[model samples]
Target: MATPQWSKFFPDFYIERLWDKCIKCRRCVSECSYEAHIWDSKKKTLLEDHSKCVGCHRCEAFCPTKALIIKRHPSDFREHALWTPWFIKNIYKQADQGGVLLTSTGCALPYKNYFDHLVLDACQVTNPPIDPLREPMELRTYIGPKPESLEIEEVNGKFRLKKKLPPLIRVEAPILFAAMSYGAISLHVHQGLARAARDLGILYNTGEGGLHASLYEYGPNTIVQCASGRFGLHVDYLNAGVAIEIKIGQGAKPGIGGHLPGEKVTEEISKTRMIPVGSDALSPAPHHDIYSIEDLRGLIFALKEATEYKKLVFVKIAAVHNVAAIASGIVRAGADAVVIDGLKGGTGAAPTMFRDNIGIPIELAISAVDKRLRAEGIRHRTSIIASGGIRCSADVVKAIALGADAVYIGTAALIAVGCTMCQRCFTGKCPWGIATNNPELMKRLPPEVAYEKIYNLVKGWTHEIKEMLGAMGINSIESLKGNRDKLRAVGLTKEEMEILEVKHAGE
Candidate 1:
């Protein structure tokens, strides 16, 4: 007998089809981009290939009769501490492919979630909590440099500023849509994010991918990025957005660059990214012109000069060790804002090793950077936008208390728009259509539908943030920024507490 393919024998997901409930509509067969379901005319029944399923649940969701149940496969190896099933399977996969393992989304390791270990303080007897319903709560946030002091001249009781203020980008909330490249995700998803950001009175980053011409009208709410590749960068593109970001590194793969396969580079993406339609888009690990902090400063000023100092310039870096020091340098180098992406940050595709092992959690990084900037008295010189693993309204509240001026949401936004996080984004076959470029799959998510869902998501989160702020006896988000006193640690060590600058829960 021929040896069996063990990988096929050990399927990750099992599709349970209820023959009684199934009406032969074959919707699941058509809906599944993974081709896990097959119709056998000779047998006059639908057949399943369990090995093909990536567990996206598209087939289950689209099944007209609700007959499909995608469940974890009922198979396991002997439990071992060091030799886990995933590790063993990965080794097997490598033996077959002999290539780097690739994965999508964020880190999935079972690391300690510091956000869960921290609790927010609420007003009691000493300070009564404000009622958000009865009173106004300020959630509006301003990004960019703030003047050290304001000098005023009183002219007939009318005050005017003595010096011109630096440019500032204002948002209705302390929430922003994270950077996601155009080719990495479908244009429909991009349009949805743009529309949602515009309607929500917030900003959405146009990742390393260049902005599409159709999105120029939403420039006021967009943060255009200039990565190492410098793709599609031009004079007009430089001035197209309210702010420009210099992407030094990504939290998903900090030390490496980016690669968009030639197959994904459609005409639209090619035009936007300024690369050939059938050519791979490769970004260098570092900007050739920027070898040091001083080099970074030159590029920062060059961008400012290119934009005539009209746009706010930001510098983004992964949350690595001494991130606070790096952020300090970025601010000194003339960045109006510094964005820090942490370990839990998501990506379209990344090597499995970097995604799991690199970078620190955003919670600690935010706190450390905040403490460092405040101590140096340059906190006012730049705004800090925290990202990577911000999940819900509670996470947002905790992040602000930990000292993030604002937070960016990527995976959460996608989840709002029907993403199941199957981690198949790199395959260009996202069944839900959120991360795919396939024409048929892209139709799954209409931009208008995505817009409504994302809009509702932000609106809901904003309401919850207001409630949290009111409970803390705070009427404005500004008060919550860098307010470590409003947070207390739970089940954390003294070392962790010192790093986070929070007291134990009881204390």
Candidate 2:
């Protein structure tokens, strides 16, 4: 068969070459939702729009031509030493007076191995293994306050409201999608998360950017975040969610304010956030009204009053030294739950030094916070959610075993929908459109496909979690929370061992 004339204009040479090998099979074009490939009848060729290609590999996988091959462009770095370290070092020295090392993603810092050094325990010969398929395992969890003690009472000729509150909020799964602000990501990405959350029966967080009007339908599965700027905050915004999260800090830029550059503050974002167009939306590190724990509590109560005690209020803080003490104060401040974000948590943009050099690890923070809460006899009053570098199902299980009521996944969710984590999210030039603010780039991530990928990834992880729980002979995730006894420290120092309160294996 002659090569189709429509294949001549393909922007990607590789795709064009592959199109030339097509044998009139519609499989590749049919499987791709973006209509990346089209059969041109007049030209007798398969045309491809490389710009719409998300690099999902669905077409390549289904192509019978063995013709489609997606790959990264080759780099010739050695050919240009001007861009190398020595040259860059001199440039940095010359520019050092005022230049900041700008970065646009999560921490790329080398850190302590708290999560990796610790290990989980499985049943041995002494303990018979349980079959996950045959057993009933529970991953159900609640994410708010629990009663310390309950008293049964009956009213005169009537029954009073139950002393114990119907678990502040129950979740069928212990994994949730973390906050990726609307300004940082696109509307389709947010919509995808919301749809996936509804399908999976889990919750999706609206980051500090404020909830968009189009996503209000997913309210029951949404956790709206209220950060320092208080963007788009109003009576309707307050009432439009299952829970409210107050962002005190983020793991990526703990001690710094968040600056969403004016370039990305488009009309939609401006309206959603109630911020003016062409002005940087700044989120200061500390709320001006909150100077102390007491002040924090006051704000918490103010929000509670504003919402009429209908929503569960969550206080989110970055993991840092003395985070345990901070968590205790947040719990005492009347937060229904506390979200701890460790150093590796993601960001749209932050100074490179801050992203790499700040904050503690989630594993250590979770362990320390749980211990402190229990020691203070306040563990029962508030739940704990952990986010930062949660890469897999094993991470989720280990986080819960270390004492997280749930694990929040941001990067993983982005990866599920084709993010390469190139760390250029702030540039608004995301090739897959998962992180860009540009409308043309943003539209690359179609809601239907992106949502499906997220749903599949979470569903796969959930099944793996069930398998792990079954193997551990634990039926419910609650039974696993804070069960450090099931975990063993492998390569810890005396101080680290003491802090984690775990022993080396076979000791």
Candidate 3:
């Protein structure tokens, strides 16, 4: 089988060999799977085939004498400010393959981060800041339908609440592990996430990948996704999850289906996903069963019924132009929680065009949906979980203040487990082993090590959230949820502020 030829649009990489430091040990040649380094026995020299380099840094890091230097291939193309080097390179890449340009990890394109523009308020002389060490600060959050008001009724000669509220999944913090499918990442990574979710007392999603049997024990903290493929779904699978998420779209690839290449569908993954090994695991763009809001509602209730009405049913969607209206519909349709994945979310693989240039920012989406739900008098009926580029505790705080009941962290979690965001997940050769499924590479990242890293990351973020809450003279994360008054926008237009429902910083 011959592969299609493609022009080298971007300089794949450049390598510099320092003769003085070169030990000729060929460590670089041994480490680099790209075949970027070579040993010339005739000349007794170490040479670099830089064209093979993807700038993964595997060889450069392993060189004992540090004899090799790896750099991005210089963009020698005539510089046009209007049509940047990246734009030109992309054009050339597409021109060569005439196929969809697949990319992985988060979009590297510089998009406006709305969370950065929004500032959280702190206490002043009028309101003294509470000492977090001495104060009772609360971060526990519940995701599900919240009753507007509880009515007391006489039951068995005793006054009791008429209707108990819907079942809610409680978390110690307002951050849950975002969905990154099993096929996208490694089995060890999944194990780490399962352990982390159980240890963190939060939730980790089984992203459309189907539940690995090993993770069934972590069921109480897992949210199993039901996407277009309906992969790995059965009575046992449905019952294993504490919650069921109807994944309509993702932040990175809105209106696009997921494609796990045939090579990635190994026997284990195939069995778990109920698909044939070495076959493409393709998910459709939209759920064929769902077309209208009524259809979406029907699916949500169907999941509830399938779960015997005990599990929380969540609807996850990309932050699109009509996100607010969509969220309203989702809530009215009986979804317990709504997850809004913003434009900047990470993915295992997505088309370059859609990943870079699609979807709305998360901050704006949360505000709009929160405002719309409040106006419709159904704000309490569904919780909001915001995901997409939630980097720090500040981002989480800002998201909650804007309207999110909780935040979902994906790329950040990967980073904690040694993902460098090289944007090469599609290659199935992640150097850090977080994204790759290859047995050798996957073993480099032990489940214990990854779990510890995740625990530390979550713990650090939790403490930071508490610190911020104490500074704001608020002790509970729930108080911060949808408290837009605590947020002020900087360098935003009146229309933006109106949409954000936040005052200008000076105001």
Candidate 4:
């Protein structure tokens, strides 16, 4: 196949060099590989190609006097209220490539985070605040089926709980690193994430990319994804992980397959993914074996039997319009847990249209799922793990209150390890070295350094969660889960407040 014709219609950005501060060091000229800067031999000065600049700020980072500045290129096109500049640029991109305009990172649309509208109730005169330092404020979370209530049975004249609960993974905090494949990010990044998961006693998802041989030691801390491609899937791989996640969809690109371009399919990635080198590895849009709830049940039970039912089986789906109904079906399908990826979820690469336009926000999805499950009396039958746009401790706390058993951290975790969210992951030339495969680029990130950063990030978030719980006079995260009474919605419509199951502020 011939390469699709494509070129930038306009210079997206330009570099501003403060000539007064420039010491003629030529660092900008030497650092930019796109040839954005060139020496004008005739005039003994530097010239910049605005079109070549991607606004990565690589040159700005290394400038001694901070003389270099990167800014959006001034546009001459008359601004249209409806047809924005970005919208116009995307039209040109597709017109050139004759393909979807792919991008990386989470949605960049101006969608309001419903999490910001919900306020947590705190202790006042009637209720006194419990200092976490003096109280046992617990953040430990377990993801899996939970018995609604304990049923006592007499065994050998001793009363014991008769319920045989399904398997669950315990973590020190409610934060779990979301799925990110080795092919999507660098091997060093995977190692760093795995190390942090191990240290934190939390899980890191292996995102449809088969487990690398080196990460086998961290198997107990892994959640291996069995995507439609069935990449690197085998009994041994299933046994290696603490849990198996049957991926139905991702939030970024719903109703579509995963795309890892051939350029990212290096020798090691090919080996791990069980795909040929230099071949695109795409996960089929739909799981051919699963079309209905029964089909889903079959896959879930099959996985349970394969691991001898030792590991919890999870189903991950993008949060769509009928997410509550979908989650209901998943719980009834015998999944131990359901992971919902909201509209703002991050991805290695996705079409711009789908990333911004599809799926429901995680905040709404979590509340809807929780309300639906509770109404059906199945909320405790399976755990709800919410992902997509979960950035900080407050987000985590709010997610639990909205009915998520635990929260998945992706972009925030990446940011903790030095991701700038430049949204050029598909290019495989990440400036911070977190998302690229090039050896030199990967060298910019060290597993040891990344491990510490991630560990510290989660550590700080965990502390903040405890502080929030203490301020609320709640000593445990369990008390916060699905506790809509403790939350009040502000600056939201009455319908929105009703759907969220939270009272309006000052009500």
Best by lDDT: 1
Clash counts for the predictions, in order:
0, 2, 0, 0
User: Local error of candidate 3 at 420, Å?
Assistant: 1.4
Worst 10 residues of 3 by lDDT: 2-11
For residues 1-507, write the lDDT of model 2, one tens digit per residue. 754343222222134436467677777666655666788889876777764554556567667877777553232235564475434533454454455666666788568757788777777787765776787777778889888877666878776656648337667799899988998898999999999999888999999898899999999899998888888888898888889998999898898878788988999999999999879999888888888989989988888889889899999999999999999999999999999999998888888878888999888899999999999999989999999899899889888888889989999999899876657677665667787667776777799988999999998999898888777777788899988887788878878877777778777
Name the best candidate (by TM-score): 1
For model 4, residues 88-189, the per-residue Cα lDDT tens digits are 778777787678788988899999889888888888999898899988888888889887788899999999878776677888888899999988998988
Q: After superposition, how far is residue 110 of candidate 1 from its true place, in Å?
A: 1.1
lDDT of 1 by residue, 59-122 (tens): 9888888999999888878999999888988887777667899999999998899999999999
What lDDT score is found at residue 419 in candidate 3?
Answer: 75
**Selected candidate, larger lDDT, 1 vs 4:** 1
What is candidate 3's lDDT per residue for 1-507, written digit by digit as tens? 665444542466788889899889998877765666888999998887765677777777778998878877765767778897777767777787788888986657777788879998999999998887898899999999888898999978999888876788999888999998888899888999989989889999999989998999999999999999989989898889899999999999999999899998888889899999989988999999999999998898898888899999999999999999999999999999999999998899999888988999898999999999999999999999999999999999999999999999999999999876668889887877888778878887899988999989999999988999999999999888889899999988899899999999978
Model 3 off-target regions past 4 Å? 1-6, 39-45, 153-160
TM-score of each: 0.98, 0.82, 0.95, 0.94
| CA lDDT, every model vs. true structure | 0.92, 0.82, 0.88, 0.89
Q: lDDT-based ranking, best first?
A: 1, 4, 3, 2
Let me know the TM-score candidate 2 reaches against the reference structure: 0.82
Runs in model 1 deviating more than 4 A are: 1-6
Please provide the root mean square deviation of candidate 2 (C-alpha atoms, Å): 7.5
Question: Alpha-carbon error at 178 in model 3, in Å?
Answer: 0.8
